[model samples]
Target: MHLIYLDEAGNSGTNLDDPHQPIHTVCGVIVKDSQWLPIETQIDALIAHLVPRVADREGFEFHNSDIFQGHGFFKGWPWPTRVDALERLLDIIVTNKLPIVWGAVDKQKHKAKYVYPAAPHDMAFLLCAERAERWFKNHAKDDVGMFIADDTKAKSDMKKSFKEYRKTIALGNRKECLEHIIDTIHFADSRETFGISFRMRLTISSSGILWAPLELSPFLSELNGMYMQEGCFRKKGAAK
Candidate 1:
């Protein structure tokens, strides 16, 4: 079995008029069951190295907003420190050769021009989940894929979408031929789940080119290139 962590990059809800969130993306960071422990160990080791230098910090989570603006525990940290820490965290994925499957929807473009019955956030998430299952089929046969998402009020909304997906896919009524997915996607706070936290950081860092106004070319370039090397879902199409 394979466990995948899902997270959103920019969620504008149903309101496309929200300028700050013009784009919405959902990404699932998937790794084989055997790789989880080693990756967790490596993440711990990296955090250990950075802790002694930054005081009053233990059990620190790698959040994009905090690292971007140097908030909370990052307030007094130098710019270089933040950059280095994020780089190392991203590097853990490459060092372990894990694959990331993501789906991005242009909210301003999609909702502004098209009509859909479902929420854009739920749609993007379900699409990403579809992609994750497809990638699992391509790489692993007969292995079930489970999803984990950030806990929210819409957690039930996401579950409903997944239920609908299974219904359609089962009856051969869906546009996307999705299968091999677990029934429910477990939800928990980001701070509680390392896998979800890892995927959130990946989603935010990888989305630098999308909504983040900052010039994160180096960040996206490094992470995207490495993810490609490890096999990522082809954008606007099926997995390669």
Candidate 2:
């Protein structure tokens, strides 16, 4: 069995016209059940190494935005130091050869393209789920997959969208019926789940793929190898 840790970045809800956040991205990292512990331990060690002075690392959460924007624990940290930490975190994913899947929605293009555009969150989540299902079908045919997503205020909304996809044709595409993903999404707090926390950077970096590719090239370039290419990163149903 496989557990897909899901997270989102740049979510502006129904207000897709937000000038600052023009894109919404949902990302999933697929981990085999057997390898989950080893990966968690690696992340725990990295956290300790990064914050050696913090006695209580148990409550510490690695927020990508915080680390990048010099907020929270990262405040007063030098630019190179902050960037180095993020790069080290990325190394964990690369070293483990984890497969990543993402769905990024360009809100302006999405809204203009459809008379009644699907909500950005809804579209992005559905796209990620679809790609996840396809990944299992292609690479891990015998294994079942599940989603463990970060608990957000939009939990009910996301659940509603997921339920619709699980039972019906989704995103105006007749081919989508997510049979590989077992049951509904399992939402959990990022503070408690290392799987979800480690994959959070993928969501933030995915938005960068559409928003500021050059600024995030180092991160995205490394991520390109991990991303499942069959779906090829969706943007309004078009593959990149």
Which candidate wins on TM-score?
A: 2
163-236 per-residue lDDT for model 2 (tens digits): 88887555554666777888888999889988877655443332344332233444445554546332223433
- Clashes per model (N, Cα, C within 3 A): 0, 0
Task: For residues 1-240, write the lDDT of model 1, one tens digit per residue.
Answer: 778888886776778666666667888788778988888888778877888655545557888778878997677888878878777877776567567887766665666566663567876776677777668677876787788888888888788878877655431364655567776878988777678756643333324343222333333444444333322223323322
What's the TM-score of every candidate structure? Answer: 0.80, 0.85
Best by lDDT: 2
**Candidate 2: deviation at residue 95, Å?**
0.8
- Model 2 spans with C-alpha error above 4 angstroms: 54-58, 171-173, 200-219, 224-240
